[model samples]
Target: MNGMTDAIALALAAVLMAGAPLVLATLGETLTEKAGIINLSLDGSILLAAMAAFAVSATFDSPWLGVAAGMAVGAAMAGALGVIGIYLGQSQLAVGFILTLLARDLAYFLGHGFSRQPGPDLGVWTIPGLGEVALIGPVFGPIFGSRSPVVHLSLAAIFLCWWWMYRTEGGIRLRAVGESPRAAFGRGIRVRLVRLCYCLAGGALVGMAGAAYSLAVKPGWGRPQGCEGAGWIVLAIVIFGGWHPVRAALGAFFFAALQVSGIYLQDIFPSIPAPVFQVAPFPMMILTLLAANLGRAGRVQDMIRRHPFLKRLSQGWSIDPPAALGQDFDPRKGL
Candidate 1:
C-alpha cells in the first residue's frame, strides 16, 4: 500500500512536469491567436527564453530573477514579429517561421558554451504545517492540500486569459480586430497598436512559459533537453482550444497527460518508439484544425475550391485554421 502510494505520487509529478511546458506555451499562444496574429516564431521565442533564463539565473544566482530575464527576451522576440507584421507588412506565417530558425540557431550558439554549467532549480514550495505528514513525504504530500506553485499560477493565468479575451472591453475590441481588422478600425480601435500590444504580451508569456520549462519542468538547464518541440505543441494547443483560454488550457492538460504518460511508459515499455509521444500533438493539431474547419465549412470549402491541390485534401478533412488565423489583414482589403 505504501509503495503504491509512492508510485502514484511519482507518476502524478511526472505527468505534471511533462505537461508544464505545454500548459505555459499553449495558454500564451491561445491569447495571441485570439488576437488574429499567429506567432509562428514561438519555437524561436521559447528557445531564446530558455537560454536567456538559464544564463541570467546563473549570472544572478537567482531563479526568480532569471525567470524575469527570460520573459523579457521572449516578449522582445514577439515584439520583433509584431514590428514586421504590423508596421513592415510582411507575411505573418512566413516571418514567424523564419524567426523560429533564427531563434533556434541563436540559442544553439549561445547555449552551447553553457551546456554543462550549473544553475538553480526551482524547488516546490508548500505550506508550513501540512508538509509534515505520515504517508506524505516532502516531494509528495498533503502540503496544505495543493499542487506546485506553478500549477496555481497556471490556473490563475487561465482565468486571466479568459477575462481578458472575453469579458473586458479591450477583449471585445481585440476579437473585433481579429475577426475583421477593417471593422475593428472603423469602430475606432487602434488596430495596429492593439495588435502589437497583444503580440508583445503574448510573447512575454511565452517566454515565461519557456523559462518554466527549464526553471521548473526540466529544473536543470541543458541545450538539447530544454524547449524541445514545445513551441509547436503549444501552437497545436491553441488550435485545439479554438482560441479560447479555458479550452486551450484543457488542451494543454490533455497534451501534458500524454507526455507524462509517455515518459512513464518508458519504464514499463522501453521499446516503444519515443517519437510517438513527441509527435502525438501534431496529429491532434490536424484534428483540431479539421474540427474548426467543420465549423466554417462554407468558407473553408470555398477557399479549397479556389486552390486546386487543397480541394482534394479538403474532401477528407475539415480545413479551417481559425476565425482569422494566419491571414495578413490589410485595411484596404476591407475584411
Candidate 2:
C-alpha cells in the first residue's frame, strides 16, 4: 500500500511538471480567444520559439535571455496575425495557417546549425518546511514542495487569469470587446487596440511555454524538439475548456495525467508497441471531448434536468466561444 501511494505521488508530481507548458499555452490561447482573436499559428510558433530559445541560451549561456528571445518571436508572429487578419481584413484562419507553415519551415531551416547543441537550463527550487509536515509529508512533499519556477508560474497564471477575467474592470472590457466589438466601440472601448494587445500578451505567454520546454521540461532542442504537436493540443484544450482560464488549466492537467498514464501503461504491458501507448492519449482526449459535448443531446439534457446535482456539475462543461471569435472588427462601421 505504501509503495502504491509513493508511486501515485511521484506520478502526480510528474504530471505537474509536464503539464506546465500546456497550462501556459492553454491560458495564453484562452486570453487571446476571449479578446476575439484566433492564433492558429501556435504549432509552428512553439517550434520556432523553442529553436530560438535554445539557440540563444547556447550562445549567451543565459537561459533568461533565451526566454526573452522566444517571447519576442511569439509576439512577433501573433502581431503579424493581428495586423494582417484583424486590421487588414484578411481571413484569420488563412493567415494563421500560412504563418504556421512559414514558422515551422523557418525553425527547421534556421535551427539546423544549433541542432543537438548544449544550452543553459533553469534550476529547480524547493519550498522549505512543507516537505517536513507530519502524516502528509510523503504525499504532499513532491507535489508542492519541489518544482521548477516555470511550473509555479503556470500554476499562478491559472488563478491570475481567472481572477482578471471574472473580477476586474479590465477583464470586463476585454470580454466586452470579444463579445461585441461594435457594442464595445459604442462604449468607448478601443476594440482593435484591445484585441491586438491581448494577442501580443497571449503570444508572449505561448513563447514562454516554448522556453519552458527548452530550458526546463524537455531540456534540449533538435530536429523534432519533442514538442511539435503540443501547440495543436493547446488549441484543442482552449476549445475543450470553453475559453475559460481555470477550466483550460484543468484541461491541461487532465491531458498531462493521460500522458503520465501512458508511461505507466508502457511499463505494465511491455508486449505492446511503445508508439501505441504514446499516441493513445490524443485519441482518448478527443473521446473525452465528445463525451462532454454529449450533454447537449436531448436524452442527456433530460437526464441532467432530472438530477439537480448533475445539472450543476454539467454547467461548467457546456459553454460556447466568444461571439466575435475569429471575426474582424472595423471601427469605421458603427454599431
Candidate 3:
C-alpha cells in the first residue's frame, strides 16, 4: 500500500512535469492567436531554443543563464517570423509551416550529440514549514517542494498573460491588433509594430517553453528529444481553450494528465505491452475528436449528411474550437 501511494505520487509529479511545457508554449501561442496570427513555427522555435539553451547551460554550468540565452534565440526566430508574416506580406500559415521543417533540421543538426545530455537542474522552492506538516507536503507533493521551477513559472505565465491581455494598456493594444488590424491602424496604432512586438514576445515564451523542457524536464538535450511534443500540442490546446490563457492551461493539464495516466496504466498492468499505452493516446485523441465534434458531418459523407441535431450543434453553437486559428491578419481584409 505504501508503494502504491509512492507510485501515485510519482504519477502526479509526472503530470506536473509534462503539463508545464505545454502550458508555457500554449500560453505564448495563445497570445499570438489572440493577435490574429498563427504560429505553426512553434515546433521549430522550441527545437532551436532547446538546443541553444542546452548548449549555453552546458558551457556556462548555470541552467538559468542557459534559459535566458535560449529565449533570445527563440525571440530572434520569432522576429524572423514577424519579418515574413507581418512585414513581407507572406502567408503566416505557409511561413510558419516551412519554419517548422527548418527548425527540425536545425535542431537535429545541432542537437544530435546533445540529445539526452545532462545539465544542471533548475531549483525548486516550497512554502516554509510545509514539510513539517505531513499532510501538506504529500498533498502539494513536489508542486512547491521538490519539483522543477518551470511549474511555478507556468502558473505565473497564466496570470501574466491574463494581465497582458486585459489589464495593461499595451496588453489592450495587442488585442486590438488581433481584433482588427485595420481598425487599430485607423486609430493610430502601429499595426506592424504591434504585431512584431507580439510575435517576438510570444516567441520568447515559446523559447522559455523549450528551456523548461531542457533544464527542468529533461535536464539535458538529445535527438528524438521532445520540443515537438508540447509545441505541437499547443495548437490543439489553444483551440481547446477557445483562445483564453486560463482555458489553455486547463487543456494543457488535461492533455498532460492523460499522458501521465498512460504510464500509470502500464505500471498497474505490467503484463500489458508498454507500447500499447504509448500509441493508445493518439487513438484516444482521435476518439475525442469524434466525441467533441459529435454532430459534425463525417468527412466522406458530408454531402449525404442528414442528422438535424448534429448539424445544428455543429453549425456554430456547441464546443466548436477556435475559428480564427492559423488565419493571418490583413489590413486589407476586415475581421
TM-score of 3: 0.84
Please write out the lDDT profile of model 2 over residues 1-335, one tens digit for every residue: 98898888889989998899999989988999999999999999988998899899999999989999998989999999999988899998999999999999999999999888777887787889887899888789878887888888999999999999999999999999999999999999999999999999899889989889888998888877888899989988898898889988999999999999999999999999999988998998888878877888999999999999999988857668899998889988868
Model 1 lDDT tens row, 1-335? 86776677777666665666667777777767767888999988888888888888888889888788888988888898889987888988888999999998898788777687878856676556554656555545632245555665676788888887778998897787778777778887887888888888888889988788778877666658556777887887776676777777777877777666666666777787887766675676667656755745587667878898877664444323456665666666564
TM-score of every model versus the real structure: 0.81, 0.96, 0.84
Report the lDDT tens digits of candidate 3 across residue range 136-194. 76656545567678888888889999987889999878777777666777888887788
Task: Give the TM-score (vs. native) of candidate 2.
Answer: 0.96
Candidates' lDDT values, in order? 0.75, 0.90, 0.77
Cand. 1 Cα-lDDT: 0.75
TM-score head-to-head 1 vs 2, winner: 2
RMSD of 3: 4.6
Q: Which candidate has the top score in TM-score?
A: 2
The candidates, ranked best first by TM-score, are 2, 3, 1
Best by lDDT: 2
**RMSD per prediction, one decimal?**
6.6, 1.3, 4.6
User: What is the overall TM-score of model 1 with all chains considered together?
Assistant: 0.81
